[model samples]
Target: MSALPAVIDGRDKRKNPMNIFAQIRELITTTLDTMVQDGTLPDGLNFDPITAEPPRDAAHGDMATNAAMVLAKPAGMKPRDIADALAAKLTSDARITSAEVAGPGFLNLRLAPSVWQAVAKTVLDEGTAFGRGTVGNGLKVNVEYVSANPTGPLHVGHTRGAVFGDALASLLDFAGFDVTREYYINDGGAQVDVLARSVYLRYQEAHGQEVAFPDGTYPGDYLIEVGEALKAKVGDDYLDKGEQYWLEDVRTFATEKMMDLIRSDLKALGVEMDVFYSEKSLYGTGLIEAALKDLKDKGLIYEGVLEPPKGKKPEDWEPREQTLFRSTDHGDDVDRPVMKSDGGWTYFAPDIAYHYDKVQRGFDLLIDVFGADHGGYVKRMKAAVSALSDGKVPLDIKLTQLVKLFKNGEPFKMSKRAGTFVTLRDVVDQVGPDVTRFVMLTRKNDAMLDFDFDKVLEQSRENPVFYVQYAHARVASVLRKAADAGIATDDATLAAADLSLLDHDSELLLLRKLAEWPRLVETAARTNEPHRVAFYLYELAGDFHGLWNKGNEVTSLRFIQEGDPATSQAKIALARATAIVIAAGLGILGVNPAEEMR
Candidate 1:
């Protein structure tokens, strides 16, 4: 492939220069503009639908664009006519070695080898910042995830939400958003009362009194220490007290202790929240009232009777006049009740107030990472945010599906320490934080994931975490080998090497993959899908491994050339660029890039 001119006239200055796809797309758009200016195409033709991406088949070309197909009708010209004209204009640019119109107006373009070579140099120059984007434009986003009730240690389901939320927050931050990692402590409900009662039983056990855990109480051994600590703090002062005498105080103390356990569980999984807002804080604080007032002022709140839930039997259903929010007006399926006829707030009332608090805090966007069981809650939460924010701010709710764990080809049993379910600590302790985090994100948040313990730990390509990490480790090995051979292997030395020597197709293929990093970051960030980052890394690792395997047959494709320092440096530059991108992707996924495989 031949190199095009480094400077193309009318290129969009806003596009990232290092993103090969963006650069080429800019060139195409600018060329289209020229077409319009020269009266070759209609002036009012819209170019928004035009896209330049890699072709589905690698044999086709380096990049493909649908400019001709998308603009043909609007330009009042045949697709081939526009394709022919566009191809001629695109080839005129020196960077494009060839532009072929294929399959009825699709334009396939190939860039010079130097364009791919420059991608390596850019990656070395930018390091971890190579794929960072400015698309967020510094918008404030609050990501509330793992807001599990502070009643016990987080379970496997909460584990998925924690990892997904943390990685998504990191991805958004990498994409230039001012992100706040938050957890809402669910402490303002009857669950805390249950927690208090559970701890009271354990407290009696600590006082050398045998107590039975009731069906509604937590039966986990993880709460034993909390009870012992409570005994140490209050002695026997409340040993024989009535429920009302110690219920509120014990509830507050137990919730804090469980929150501490939750925090430790999160830390074990490498998640740390920027904020931990409390649900109890909204009660008796006028915050809930203020939020409802905001909706009422907008004429969204009224006392009305809701239809009995459709699936409920007549005897089980009761229609009552209650204070309700006109949620349907804001896209919810039905108006939601804010308060009962007896003047008690419903569960959703506090949630609405919580999000209203987020909206009032000046966030440009809000994201809630909830377990899949909360799927039914999505629409109402969105409606609340839409109504509360007056449609100025957008809310994106991501529901993480269940993670079914298996050990030795059998379903993993519940943790003995947690009593009824597997806790986050159990998962992290068994596989380690890095493995836990990476494996949790292997699937989309909304899809069910089967986390086979034996499979995930296997050192095989089927294990994506190991596969990606091994690629990074392989690059590290190459750097070590280059160093032992007395070759200059630092990024600056390799970047300044004679990169023109990297003319092999395998090397160029790796470079092409590196060039997609920035584009991938932007696309994944725009869609709020951090799992896409994990997917891209796996694909990138496969490409790197393919090139590595090719080196075994074709000696010239090896990352190091014996006695040829210049060629070795050029090839090493490619390897180092691959590592840089893998590390950057892992950073976004909250996984540490392994320097050497164990």
Candidate 2:
């Protein structure tokens, strides 16, 4: 479950062996080139814009190309005339059953049934390699996510970002990108200072002294054990010491415990980060000074006085000279202050240094996943990245919105142990990691998700996670039945079957949906969206379920035909191919395909 897809090399465009859409696109391009060489059209025509896409209405054809409309203006001819000529050329190919010119010169193509049958065979032959794409070109990408402050346990918000970022990294890997999943620990922030004080009170209570948890302190029961552990290690050593005497040691010890708790929580949800970057390492190490020096040398840093913010100006809004970064020059709404008037760094200073370190790591692209409340940080961070990298690296910031939990159609109660927000471990313990991962990706990162506990566990069509898993399980059951009936249904045998027998419309529809996988993988990777993979798997499961239901009414539509092993072999090949795609898609989402639904 942890292994990523293999990277694909080589950029030869001579008919992709596994991608049906790319194969047809290549065929169309070659035909157009032949037309130009024969002087049927004009010379030096650009074919980059010629696209092959499925028609909005499937009744029009299996696939439709806008080659005529795209090339007509450049070739100095009417679209209909170009479409008519292209139709004649395409009709000569054995795979194309029909190529008709429709309104506005759309070239609608219907392929022979054998073309789709070949797609099923290809899926069996390639297995998980069926939808792998080479679009990323093996470029290095750094995805920083779930950098929750080391103050307490992770809530539901951080859980969503963790799932989304991990899936997106896997999706990018599937598309051939070398991805590094990273987490930047905010251990140097003021929040960690608060955490040290909170643990100090707990440590006092461990020594049989009653301590009151005031408004600014964390009161969760999780820290009670940390207090007891501190008492066990060094009893009363810093009981009455001054703040400076114990602040550093307490902060270091508390931050380590909190990070250990976070790691355990993330592991419960099946997340493993490759790197955990500490913010405290940036201070007194010349990193922040070096980053600011880089900006100062570029003439992007200056002393300035900022005007009061809109709608919320401070009562004492006196103007003071502060060191600011010229974020406006890099497309921010306003310049941002990096150093305060007191000669100390603001919060933005450390963030700028962090991104500068990432840029120096030689990554081609950077992606930051933050919670929705950090919406204001998006522009400033992007501007900093653009300025720091000199516009050489692209940064994409994904903000995951809130998650509302439900159980039995009612809002879930907060964990007593967590005291405020529900802990990620609470959710994972209630429902396993597979359901959590799948439901988290059912919506885009920007959209809110309502995670219904009971619905996800229900064995019905309305539950997409259950529905998809059932489809794969159903295929397993069918294979078992075929084996019991003394039929050889291995991949080698299925691949060599006479797939020409699979000409029914229901069978061909399943093949068409399977053909869209490679294209879908490339599109999802290009857009940095992993939700598309979940959606595709749900739709594919529906197509497979529909074909399975059709067998109830049509005797010939059943996958295991009685007294006809040849027909059964052809039909079972489609079923096996569908399962292979479902398994591959679930793998990208970091979920193991369920062999049985219980």
Candidate 3:
């Protein structure tokens, strides 16, 4: 069986598609297997990392496999010797045109240019289905993200996690995984109580009573309407009542209102979640207790005093004994408290139950997208999942680094007097979802992103998002022009368009970049990091843009071959293929591809 990464999907969405590159991988591995049978590579060797990656430079080849380098030590030969033998063998294959050894034993394989033309035709034939490569089979996965507290509307920080998670889920779906998008409600915490008090102040104001906003009580006027609505619903039923009489009802009412606001906030940003699990549900019903009991039964829980954390210990640093989980056994620093001294569950309690519920739901994998602020939470959460699932489930927690906002090189400080912060709607409204999503993904999950208000909106080539989108739009415009000029835009015509006419080195390099799409998708999906998709799209767009500019110098390279419909159709097919890949990538990012730039 070929190795496949697991993907998560929900009730909707198609599972991952096994792409052309994966087929190539299987073929290459089969070739190796045959070699082993015929006494070429030694039998006892690990080939897990034997990858077929595109070279950074296209002049190197269409595709380069590390098989030569990997088998060098095992085959007891010099890297070059192994590469030479491998090249000689691969050159015999029908798909390979030329195989040459480069560098210190790197085997570069150049396929027939017909191979690239066929790729374009394949993409046209498949449409959106072209790049749906499955490194991930239908394994159940839960992607938890943007579980921002329902205290207010989502801020700019939540926007990054929201876009990252939504795009990631889309990418995984295309890569063939059963995925569930979940949001864990934080309504069970002290934050919710604060929300209630804030709403009460609003309710009192609605009753024509003067109210002063207190510290820690949410001062965002967002909850004022919720408070007014509450007053209209209950008619001061709990008016002047103590906390015992109204706290629960207010919290329930306020949280529902907050969640409604949050849902609308997500809708404004084009994000949707499959499930919204309430952290409050984990308490009182013995769910958190049951999760803890399960761990305790497995000897992973106990009562103990934890040493103060490495940094400054709390001023209240009495190491009073508390109920602790033996997280160290599962790879955590010391033990972690499941319950506080006051007989209340720690914040980690429901989190454990939440993950346990996910594992219990039969998901094969779990992914959590958290902000960089929660970087310290990674190990403990991993430890909990490890202990709860008994190692059956693998959890990958991605920490989205901070997004620094800048307006023309000045740090864009969020206006404190304006409100709690900027919402996802602000960014989407200003830049549109495509730019917002693409810009957020330009950096890796762990690296900080500088979101410049002015720069991303600039239509220059330096702005990666616009540059990529422009390439797609430019290609689309050329295709439209070709059709208007009576050029056949059908796949069959383009497929037979004397692709042999594409002999220029510039055209060949573009074709090679096109070939890398399938491989790039499979790799990005395998790593479960959609940022790779963003990078690949930028690079592909870069190649396309360079080729487009080349047309100014080389008249024949222009996509619109004047007076020749067939040749124009052939040239336009490459442009169409470029748009198709960009659209595919934008689809994964949950961003819409423009047919033309407006």
Candidate 4:
């Protein structure tokens, strides 16, 4: 049987909730309250400190709590005295079979087998909504990621950030957060000028002129099409003109085409953004000036000279009075410049404006997914958001470390189209979107990931994507076999089965793992890390595979039992629930669960 076991009728589906962990936690809380009301424990106790979580050692019990230790000092009573009284009150519940106090004051409670069986039924009834929770309480959150410069195609690094950010958004949405995915285009930067110059050379080439690409100009083949499009629109009009005549028009045109290329790449990876904000808009629309005015009104903007950065000052570094933001007052290490000595706004000016816009959008939380190279920017970015929102809005910045790609034990070559880096298209086209997304999330966002093409595709235990997909496919096979044997295996029929038939140690262990889904989802969502979902899915798959292999040698443990419909349906119910959970988890990661392994 796959991890969870399920058995429920239509009425049971509407009445019974899915989270067994929460149920047991409530039971523990209610038992503690009863003890307080009966005068066995002291009154006016703050039960907020009480916790019900699975014990580190499974043999101790299914769930353990430190209620006795937490309340002993407050109530002026010995911990063991409180624990003894609490355990006696808890064992009266039919769901909890045993409650014991161990060590000093911990209470270990073992629930009945029926409770775990009910978890399985919940999975079958709820399907993919099995692990869904409401931890966000409908708070609005803005997740900005893959805001790569509009000058070029996204490389491997941006791909990791994209996958991580997209999946994290999905996980938050599942946890009931109002999530908005955004991308900030850096079209106002100097890099777009270089892109325009590079495209100008390609435009000359399209006009049948020999133009040389200099060291500063981009020489990527991607610009060839944009240049051709430009030549087609304005043929020979600015062919020999100076930089004044065509620089602005070419910059605007090339940035738009590059953004189109980026959008196509993201579409290939199945990532969609709710908003695409432009940096160029901030410059002309008084947005940056307004943000600086807000800071100036609060005494956060001033004219000051910054000290040379500690340990690593540029050789040309010199003190100059400039428009500065007092970021140091809001936890930044030092004051940051907002405008340069030449009366032009510094890069931080637009960034502050962008965050101010996000704050003005009324989001309760803001999250930025950046590359590891932006580590130094976290402090100032947080300070900017804090000063902009006056500490009412919170900003979380997650940095995705580097991803090194390999194929057949050697480094993957760079993409010719992108000039120096491998584009996201190269990775997705080779591995497909599902494998790419799952493998990208196998490691935490801050850890360096080694993505091996040959290894990820192999159908082995070492490949987490294959391993998890295989588990789902195995359950599909079980349903097929049950149907071929003239047995009904629909979810409604399986939910009505007698789940008490599943009593083996292996089956119960799988069920316990399945029961962790809701708790895990809430924790993952709170941390803003979708990699936890991938890790949990891999572990759940391992447990399911272990049970499937055990059934080969143990006759009654098999999902199908010939000539016994009742027994077979009961065991098949467990398998069906496991598939439902695996599918649900894959959905969170933006991966499609396989129906059958090829």
Tell me each candidate's TM-score: 0.96, 0.95, 0.93, 0.95
Model 1 poorest ten-residue lDDT run: 1-10
List ranges where model 4 is wrong by over 4 Å.
Answer: 1-17, 412-420
Model 1 ranges with Cα > 4 A deviation: 1-14, 413-420
lDDT of 4 by residue, 394-470 (tens): 88899999998898979775754446578888889899999999999999999999998899899999999999999
Candidate 1 lDDT by residue in tens digits, 230-302: 9999999879889998899999999999898899999988899999999999999999999999999999999
Model 2, residue 588: C-alpha shift (Å):
0.8
Q: RMSD in angstroms, candidate 2?
A: 3.5
lDDT of 2 by residue, 282-355 (tens): 99999999999998888999999988788987898888899999999998998999998988889899999999
Task: Write model 3 residue lDDT over 374-447, tens digit each, in one string.
Answer: 98898899899999989878888888988889878998767545573777878888988778888998888789
Candidate 4 has an lDDT of 0.88
Using TM-score as the yardstick, the better of models 3 and 4 is 4
**Deviation from native of the Cα of residue 518 in model 3, angstroms:** 1.9
TM-score of 2: 0.95
**Residue 59, candidate 1: alpha-carbon lDDT:** 83
